[model samples]
Target: MNKLVTFIGNGNMALSIAKGLKNNYDIEVVGRNIEKLNKFEEELGVKVQKHLMDNFDISNKTIIFCVKPANVECVSERLEGKARVVFSVLAGTTIKKLRDNLNPEGVVRCMPNLAASVGESMTTLTGDEEYKKEAQELLGAIGPTRWLASEKELDIATALAGSGPAYLALIAEALADGAVKQGLKRDDAMAIMRGLFGGFGKLIQEIHPALLKDGVMSPGGTTAAGYGALEDGNVRSACIDAINKAYKKAVELS
Candidate 1:
C-alpha cells in the first residue's frame, strides 16, 4: 500500500502538489471549508480524505503546509499536535517560524512553481538534513528537485525557480503577441510559440543558453535581427533586475 500524505491547505499550490502526488501516494487534505475540499477532490479526479482544519492532529503524519504566510500563526494554533515532518511551500516563510509555531519533528522549506500540476516543477528545498531523502522522494514525484545547503541559497532559488513560471508566462505571451502583430493568426502564433518553447526546453537541458542562441543565429540572419532587438530592449538586464527584486522580496517576507 502507498503511504498517506497530508496537505494542510487546499489552495492552488496544494491542489497542484496533490495532482502530481496522487499516483504515488494517498492524499488527505485538511481545509477550513468543506466545499473547497470537495472541489479539490473533484478537480484532482481522485478520492481523498478530507478534514476540517480545526483542532486537527498532525501526529506521525508527513505534512505539506500550504497556508498563506500571514495566516501561519492562526493555522498553526489550530493544529493540535506535532507533525512527523513538515514540507512547507509557503513563499517567504522561514523554517524557524514553522518549527517554532507547528513544532514539527522536521521542517523543510520547499519552493515549487505552478508546473507542479504537470509534474514539472523545478522544486528547491532546504532544512533538516534528517528529512532530505524523504523530501526528495516526495517532491521529486512532482519534478526535478535541487537540495540546497542553506536557507539563504534556497531563498535565492525561490526567487528563480518558485517565481519563474510567471516570468516565463510573460515572455511567452509577448512572443505570441509579437507574432500576431506581424500578421500571423493568433491561434497559429500561440501554437508556434508553445512548440518553440517545448523544443527549447529540451535543447537547454543539453547546452548552455548562449550556445543554443549562437547555434540559431547566423550573420545578419532573422534570428540575429530578433536577438539584437531583444538586446537593444535590455531584456537581459531586465531579467537580472527581476531576479534581484524577487530575491529581496522573499527576504523581506521572511
Candidate 2:
C-alpha cells in the first residue's frame, strides 16, 4: 500500500509540502477551514479531510504538524497513539518536548524555508537514526533535505534557513531602493536588482563565497568602494546582530 502522508494544518507551509508531494505520494490535507481546504483540494487535485480540533485519527498515517509552536502540544495530545511518525515544522519545539507530548513512535523536527513553494528549499532534518530513512523519504519530496545529527543544530537552522528568506528579501528591497535613489525607475531598478542578486546566487553556488568576494574586490575599483562603505556602515555586525536576535526569539518561543 502507498504510504499515507497526512498534514495537520492547511497553512502555507502545509500547502507547499502537499503540492510538492502531489505526484509522489498519497497526500491528505486536514483542517477546520472546509472552504479553503476544498479549494486547495480542487487546485492541487489531492484529497481533503475535515479535521475538528477535538477529534481526528492520525495513527495510520505519517502526520506532518504544520500548526504554530504554541498549538502543537494541544494537537499532539489529540493525536496521541494514532500517528506513527510525527513530523513538525514548528520552530524551536524540541524533539524532547514533542516526544513527551505526542508519544509517537518517532518525532522528526524540520526547518524548511519559504522556497519550498518552488521546490528549492534548504531543509534541515533531525531525529532518531532508526526513523531517519522514513523521515528523509517524506521530506525529500519537498526539497533537498539534510540530516543534522545534533537536534540543537535545528535551532541554528531555524535562524538561518527559516528566517533567512526575510533577510534576503530585505536586502533585495534595499538594493532596489538604492537604485531608485540613484534616479532609476522603480520597475527597472527592481528588475536590475533581481538579475544582480540572481547572478550573485549563481556565483556563490559555483565558487566559494570568500573567493567570490575577493574576486569582486579588485584594487581601487567600484566594488571595493562599495565594500568599504558597507564595512564603514558595519553591515556585517548588523547582520550578526539580526541573526542573534532571531535565535534568541526562537529560544524564548520554544
Candidate 3:
C-alpha cells in the first residue's frame, strides 16, 4: 500500500504536488470549501480522501502545507492535533513559525516550482537536522531535491529555483518576440523557441553555462553579435540585481 500524504490546501500548488505524488501516495486534502476540494480531486484525475478544515486532527499524519503564508496562523489554530511532520511550501515562511503554529514533530521548508506538476521541480529544503533524510526521500519523489545546511541558504534557493521559472518565462517570451520582429513568422518563432529551450535544458545539465556560451560564440559571428547586444542592454547586471531584489523580498516576507 502507498503511504498517506495529507495536503492542507486545495490550491494550485497543492494540486501540482498531488499530481506528482498521486501514483506514489494516498492523498487526503483538507480545505474549507467542499466544491473546491471536489474540483481538486477532479483536476488531479485521482480519487482523494477529503476533509473539511474545521477542527481537523492532524495527529500521526504527514502534511504538505500549501496555504498562503498570510493564513498560516489562522489555519494553524483550527488543526486539532500534532502532525507527525509538516513539509510547508509557503514561500518565506520559517520552520520556527511552522513548529510554533502547526505543532509538528518535524518541520521542513520546501521550495518547489510549478514544474512539480511534471516531476521536474528543482526543490530546495531545510529544517530540523534529524528530518533531513525523510525530507529528501519524500520530496525527491517529485524532482531533484537539494538539502541545504541552513534556513538562510534555503531562503536564497527560494529566490532562485522558486522564482526562476517566471524569470525564464519572461526571457522566453522576449526571445520569441525578437524573432517575430526579425520577420520570422510568429508560429515558427514560437516553435523554434520551444525547441531551443528544450535542448538547452538537457545540454545545461552537462556543461557549465560559461563553457556553453564560449563554445557557441565564434569570433564576430551571429552569436557574438547577439551576445554583445545582450551585454550592451545590461541584461547580466539586471539578472544579478533581480536575484538580490528577490532574495531581499523573501527575507522581508519572512
What is the per-residue lDDT of model 3 for residues 1-254, given as tens digits with 9 covering 90 to 100? 12999999999989988887888899999999999999999999999999999999999899999999999999998889999989999999988889989889889899999789888999999988887887888788779999998888988998889999999999999999999999999999999999999999999999999999999999989999999999999999998888899999899889
Pairs in clash, predicted candidate 3 = none
Given candidate 3, what's the lDDT at residue 71?
99
- lDDT per residue for candidate 1 within 1-254, as digits (tens), equals 12899999999999988888898799999999999999999999999999999999999899999999999999998889888999999999999999999999899999999899888999999999999988989999889999999989988998899888899999999999999998999999999999999999999999998898889999999999999999999999999999999999999999
What TM-score against the true fold does each predicted structure earn? 0.97, 0.93, 0.98
Against the correct fold, how does model 3 do in TM-score? 0.98
Q: Which stretches of candidate 1 lie over 4 Å from their true place?
A: none
Error of 2 at 43 (Å): 3.8
Model 1: lowest-lDDT 10 consecutive positions: 1-10
| Model 3 misplaced regions, further than 4 Å | none
* Predicted structure with the largest lDDT when compared to the true one: 1
> What CA RMSD would you report for each candidate?
1.3, 1.7, 1.2
Error of 1 at 184 (Å): 1.1
Pick out the ten consecutive residues of candidate 2 with the lowest summed lDDT: 46-55
List pairs with backbone clashes in candidate 1: none
